[model samples]
Target: MLEAQSRHGRTVLTTLCVLALLACNRPPEIQHDAVFGPSHGAVGDTLWFSARALDPDGDSVGVRVAWGADDTSGWTGFDVPGKLESLSYVWHDDGYRIVTAQARDIRGALSNWSLGRGVSIGVAPVRPEPPIGPGYVQLDREYAFRAVSRDTSGHERRLRYVFDWGRGKLDTAAVSYPSGDTVIHRHTWRTPGTYEVRVKAITDRVGIPSAWSEPRRVLVDSALGSLIWQYVLGAEVHSSPALDEERGLLYVGCDDFRLYAVTTAGGPVWQFVTSGRVRTTPAVAPDGAVVFGSDDETLYCVGPDGLLRWRHGLADKPGPAPALGPGGAVAIGDESGRIHVRAPDAGEWRSYRTGGRVRCGPAFGADGTVYAGSDDRLLYALTPACSLLWSYPATGRIRGSPAIGAGGTVHFGCDDGAFYAVAPDGGFRWRYKAGGDINCSPAIGADGTVYVGSDDRWFYALDSSGRVRWRFKSDGRIKSSPALGDNGEILFGADGGSFCVLNGWGDLMWDYDAGNDIQTGPVVGSDSTVYLAGTDGRLHALRTGCRLATDAPWPMYRHDARRSARAGGPH
Candidate 1:
């Protein structure tokens, strides 16, 4: 029994030895490799760090990562041998950040941290320069606007520029790294006015804006000179004035039975007396002589100095102004249904009789064909020799003179409230029906759109197909013809005593009050000044520049009698 008990004790001892050996061989321990990453980066830059770890017993492992800048990511677990663990952290301030990592075994045994990777985050200090402006820029002209920025932290970076044009326009510009702090931009103003501009700088990386620069006032002046002066006459001036741009002279007839030659400065150059009211706009001869008809049934010619040159008695009162034909021949229409052709010496060349009263001036075609509209509802295409080429019958009395288009299309309006586009050979191209009697003539625009006003108190723009493109309504009947401005603007006066300016799309741009009915159309000067006459006997000059009809001299009625073609304004 003692031998058996000893043997049982030895067996138990052997079992204890086996359990101790198993306890000594515990779960795998983990070892970490050196940590590595970039040393420095800008603030807000993401820093990436990498570390290598392994489990000694080839067991699954977990890693804890810590960024010394008060940032940490939770533990991550992995089972692969010699696996790399990576973590990225963004720095928000300027400071040194150390990244360290430790490994843990499946048995919860943890190793010391690996070598730390140090990263320095920096913020570049900056000062913004004040924005500079041209101070005085001409309207419609592009000028340079500039701003600058300085980096005081000795670090290179990209920057963004924001410019406030003060005209309800904001602009942004960017400069890449290695570019100078100074930046230049360009802008233009559409109208003559005063504005203020400012600018600021922002970091492209962080989108942080610096202080705005000081404000700069910019003065924009009209490229077209402003209103110099105005001249008031004795009676209402219904006559559309003529401008002699070379001589800076302006001529107009008045209801007081007088003709006056005024300088562009609004001073009277000369005055002539007529026996009756001068309703006709005067035509300037090649020799600078003025020829016009009067209600006294007399066609008078006066020198540029306002001296009487000659006078011819007509059978009836002349309704339409005279037109100058090739070789200085003057064509005048009287209510007697006769177109009296006079030579430069004031001698009659021919008097062609029509079926109806001739009430409109003549417009010549490119082929020298004379066009005249009559109360008999006919538009006669006559040769310069007083022979009729063809007569196109209209729906109503053709009181408005014809305007020649670029493609030889003749555009005119009649009392029947229809605007007609007749071919050069007097063939009907198209007809546009308006809301009222078409008393004023039609003006051809640069885009081949026909502009005309009707007694129905509406202004219309018609395409070549006679389709209405756009229309604007006025308060009163529009008897005054519309004029083109240098900037694609439409100018006309309404019987309601309102002169309105419309943009290319028939949008109202501006307006003025004349206090009295405006029977005469406005004329634009070379410098973009608008000259308008009113029944109040006062002529007003306003600075409203346009880009249309710049090369035209009194485009509508009186200035150039050769043809009613208006050259487009500045492009």
Candidate 2:
């Protein structure tokens, strides 16, 4: 018994000594490499980089490339999709700024120090100078737009242009002009309106912006520039469709003017119809009511049971589509140049008038101002109470709708073959000229870049300052607005029934053709489905690339009863 106790004590001491030695010799783990980038960029712009790290063991390992930006502050990073490759970024903003990048290997390690190769990013690229101009044009009796001049620096300033119509603007690009100056040589617009167009002449040899030009007015026609299409409601069907998300079902409208609900991945479940052409896009109200407008000029609120709860009408036929605003008010324009704002229940409807036909829909600014165009060659800025605030003139008919962005920057295209940017106070910022008419609406990214299509068979990406970053030529005229993905992919349709995806830099990612003209805008749903209505009478729910299958039917984005093929909503 004495020997056994002694042996046990000796074993315990030996184990304790071994542990102490191991603890003293062990080293700390190394940190992973990191990458950083500009959270905002044009489609083809480079991502910035920064590499910082440390190894507790005093030994370092190289970092593997990852995804885009990693945080809300700017751009973040993620794991590389496949092959191991180094990544970089560039800045479109002025001045040099520091950005951080995170890198890693198969081992789950992290880095803190933003120093070393591939760890810390360098400063952004220099801004390309604006184009030069002594060019100008008169759009109509009310306004005249022109391109004055620019500064040449950075890359290459190539082109310049102006619009003085229903929608007015200045044009610029990073390309050289005839005078051997780096300038935005060609700029165009469709409608003429109010503007203050300017360009900073630039080139790789000469850098920075030059003196600005005085403001100008652009004229536009109210009727000719607008694009309207005939719509056919189901002669074989009767009911309106309810977009049921969770069930992947599309409630059908029947030929008997009744409703039919069906599964998206499956088939029809049920449907109900109205007394007239169910040409209206159904609105799922806050109270679970499926409200919609009709050719009968009556607005009806229906229960989930397909029962009508309440109905209202415009004093006359609402010749235009409706805009359902924040408060429960229904807004629509008429053929007689009148705009009606009404409550859900029947009562005296408020009306506002313009100088021409209210063919285009009304857009509400953040301050409750109403913007609508007319055949009278004017773009009227109106008060919420139906009073005219300001009127911008145009050269051709003002048919295009307007898109408002940060700081009240307005974007729209016109038949005058020009794209225009306007300030909140009804002044012009700039414009770009294209070879063809512009019927497409504009899409604004979080970074303030604007994307739009034109009848000139081209799609363009413009920077915040109205400079053309890049342009992609298409086989057919682009009448649709682009649908932007969370990952920065641009999805859109063409007049030739083609669907395509554009990378951040205006490069063609991929495309698909459905064998019919797709005049509707593509909508990106939460379930990753893309919805589009084609002239072939088919509603498509596809992946961003237009190859994957979808589960919904009606993808019309209009908030009113007129879900026509006309280019009204933002595509």
Candidate 3:
């Protein structure tokens, strides 16, 4: 009985195998129900698939759906739809994650996965954003600057900015995202002249600083080819020098305790020893005698041979360079708060006790009224007899000498950072504020306009009302008084180590570099030749670009020159 059953099982298995082989050799029918969906979709988009089976016997059959997750994954069963032919699932939160679905007919017998009836489901890519901005930065005012940055993946981008002048910094500090387009930004000058404004833009990055914008040089005023300066005494000069044409010598003084005699060739020929450093220029008499003041509290009389002739002690620290009055008499001020008058060949005369220390050299008005400024911030008008006529208070200490104007106006710069035009009666006429201290005396023109430089690095032209008519910004501080050319151009020196020429409108005409500070005032020659000395121990000469001449110099007034002479004596 066992043998008969075994034979029967073998005969049935053999017949089934033969049938499967025959079916394998036949071609697939390839019939399928259609499935449709969006050609492209974001992650989480849904898809649909449907199919029906036609098996020679019309019986209910199971249709298994299968898919693969990656190149390493073998085919696995994908979930079937509950009641509808569509199935929805979120695309995994990863880029390029492969997804797939297949539809199969519900057949009673199972068959292998078929390629002809299935479709692929792939994820679409996403675009990433660029970073906000970079590191620290600076830009010019009104400059169109950009802040650029990139993503972790190295995608490039740019940023925008709003510069704030009132704050002297940037307007926005946000780590804002960048737009695809370029943005415009602007900066403005709060004051006229040349300026180095900074512009910066932060990127999307939280901590990185944006790069500085390209330097945009805006000229609120012209600064081209300004003058360069030179020196001849090999020391810091507080007073300007005088050229003794007949003797071909430059008489000047320095804080170095000596009165220097500089030859036109630019080297010291002789030096007169003083009890103290000579801060005032010498007054050369026809007799060749040199008169000046020394901080050692004495007035020095030096012979042309460079010998000290006399030393008149005032018993006070002289802060002013001596000014010449009549009869070779000299007027000098000291830190003792007194202005003294004495004869060139004699000792002390009358002295006036000013309210404060007098640092500036006194000016001789046409009528013998002395005009001078004190650390007390007052401009005093005194009689030749040493009695004060009036005392006017300025906003600050006045260092520059006061020039008498056509309207009886006195123009001078104050430590208040402004130039003032005051009436001889001690009334304020006008004041123009510069960006910095104006320690320079003003050069007055026939038109009532005033010219002066400030620590603000600017040379300015001011109207009678103290309004700025024009201004020129420079690369350095302007501490020297301006020498107006006879034709209306201006000459001045800058801490930038150069003396420059400017047109009437403040346009730069030419410049010469002396590579040193110029503390001396400029003098124009008769032929319009300009002479200025720098701390470099050289005297520079320029021509035709300014308004005054080197020959007939408009007195820079105070006790300004290393030596000033009118007919003869210290007066």
On TM-score, the candidate that comes out on top is: 1
Q: Clash number for model 1?
A: 11
Query: Over the stretch 1-571, how does candidate 2's per-residue lDDT look in tens digits?
Result: 1122245455355666666655554222223433443433332346544434433433333443333243213222333322233446443444333344443332334444343332222222233232222112223312222233432333334433322122323344444453333322333444544334443333222233333434332222332211122223344321223354544544433234444444455354445556755443354544445555555656666766667887777444443335544445556665677767654343346777777766555556656566666657577776656667887776655555566666666666667777777776788888788777766556677677888888888888888888888888877888776656544566678877787766555655456675677655654555555555555655555544222111111122331122221222212
Q: Which stretches of candidate 1 lie over 4 Å from their true place?
A: 1-168, 171-228, 343-348, 547-555, 558-571
TM-score of candidate 3 against the unseen true structure: 0.55
Model 3 gets an lDDT of: 0.57
Candidate 3 displacement at residue 375 in angstroms: 0.8
Best-fitting candidate, scored by lDDT? 1
Candidate number that wins on lDDT, 2 or 3: 3
Q: Model 1 over residues 254-323: C-alpha lDDT tens digits?
A: 8898988888788988788888888887777656788888999998988878889888888898966777
Whole-model lDDT per candidate: 0.72, 0.50, 0.57
